[model samples]
Target: MSERTGWDRRLRVRADGKGLVGHAGVVLLRRCADQVGLTGALAAVLPVGVGHGWRERAAVVVQLAVAIALGAVNLSEAEQLALHHRNLFGPAASDSTTRRTLAALDESALTRMAKARRTVRRHVWSLLHLRPGGFPWLSVAGRRLKGWIVVDMDATVITAASKKERAAATF
Candidate 1:
């Protein structure tokens, strides 16, 4: 079929009981996350009954992941997703709530969380039919070579808009 361009079709608004979803794609991604057993894994790792009214660990992690995937630079930006479907998406977590949740986690909790994350990663990789081994071969300048991936993590200087404890010129 030939591709059609421009606004050939007219747009209309339907005021039905159906709600509008801003990050609709994220909902699909959440389903995939659920399929990969992320929720159960996170529940096993994270502390229980810690959040009085705060969202659960699995929900918070998925929400944060969705926000990050949608190009949210900070935790406060999660409100953008929550605003569209507050009822369907569950309770919206404030920036302070997210911060406090992370801060309250001890070393043991952190370790468990990491292990759970690793399990989720492995499950996702398996679902995508990706093998765990050496890097795939890449063609460069018409020559095939086993590609090697390198990651560099370095601290950079940034000016904070507000005063923060231990805030320095560089991290």
Candidate 2:
């Protein structure tokens, strides 16, 4: 199969087979260290809930990197897509393992991970690059368009089973 080219390269996306986690993560992390203060930033990043021995916990990073690589980008999809690609990462994980890992990364854990990594932060801000110019594609009105971005958020409802938990704020 020849490498993807032309418009297919632009809109429809696919992985390069190079693992997105280790190498891509190193690149991204370095960019982050440059823009934001490294120690302070890393330290400031809260834990994604309790770390689980780095074995089962490895899923956190793998899932995240792959999801970002594929542009699914949301936590739920991140969890789902991560499961879908587990074999690509090596060592086939049973559907149950995937479910358990994802369940462990439940809302609270995801919030902590997002908080600790400042996952929502811009790469330019995190990497220290001044945000890119000329509307991602460069057209007449593209200049005025929002460039290089993805907006994400999460919400949960605590049923009557838990009276201690309550909606903090209203939109």
Candidate 3:
């Protein structure tokens, strides 16, 4: 067998005006936001600070939600969007900015946000033709069970190859 382990270009390069191209999926999210009035609803419910721009509050909240949906465990992941799709998502908030924004939420703001989210959810469900169904039931062993749900949270097993804090042989 020949030993060749490097990537080879298959397509000719064409000079494009833009250098960045990724996270095109965010376009779908933007369209969905427009269709469901997500940003508008959020703007109506969220509090705007003195420095807030016309759409800053909605933009930040929507970006955070999108980041979470895209599997961001922390606010720093917002930087990925900033790097790749800044034009699509607008200016991405820094990790500290995101943390401070969320931390500033008060009880009344939380309640309003909840209401807005519910409203937006209903609108989107209707637009998507989603039917809210009751809890799934199960029939097993000649018995019928209603309102049954199951969750399995399997734990990870770690083996101690070296000694450290709280390190055990097996956990």
TM-score on alpha carbons, each prediction? 0.58, 0.34, 0.58
Q: Estimate the lDDT of model 1.
A: 0.65
Off by over 4 Å in 1: 1-17, 50-54, 127-171
lDDT of model number 2: 0.45
Kindly give the stretch of ten consecutive residues in candidate 2 with the minimal lDDT sum: 2-11
- Alpha-carbon local distance difference test for all models: 0.65, 0.45, 0.64
Error of 2 at 69 (Å): 7.9
RMSD of 2: 15.3
The window of 10 residues in a row where model 1 has the poorest summed lDDT is 2-11
Query: For candidate 1, lDDT tens digit of each residue in 33-101?
Result: 766888789877876674368568666777777778888888788766655546455577777767777
Per-residue lDDT over 39-120 for candidate 2, one digit per residue giving the tens place of the 0 to 100 score: 2343343233445433334434544554567675566666566555443343333445445656666676666656645653
How many angstroms is residue 5 displaced in model 3 relative to the true structure, after the best TM-score fit?
Answer: 46
Q: How are the candidates ranked when ordered by lDDT, highest leading?
A: 1, 3, 2
Evaluation by TM-score, superior candidate among 2 and 3: 3
Error of 2 at 147 (Å): 4.1
Model 3: per-residue lDDT, tens digit, 93-141?
7777777778878899889888988998877556545535633346679
Give the TM-score comparing model 2 with the true structure, all chains together.
0.34
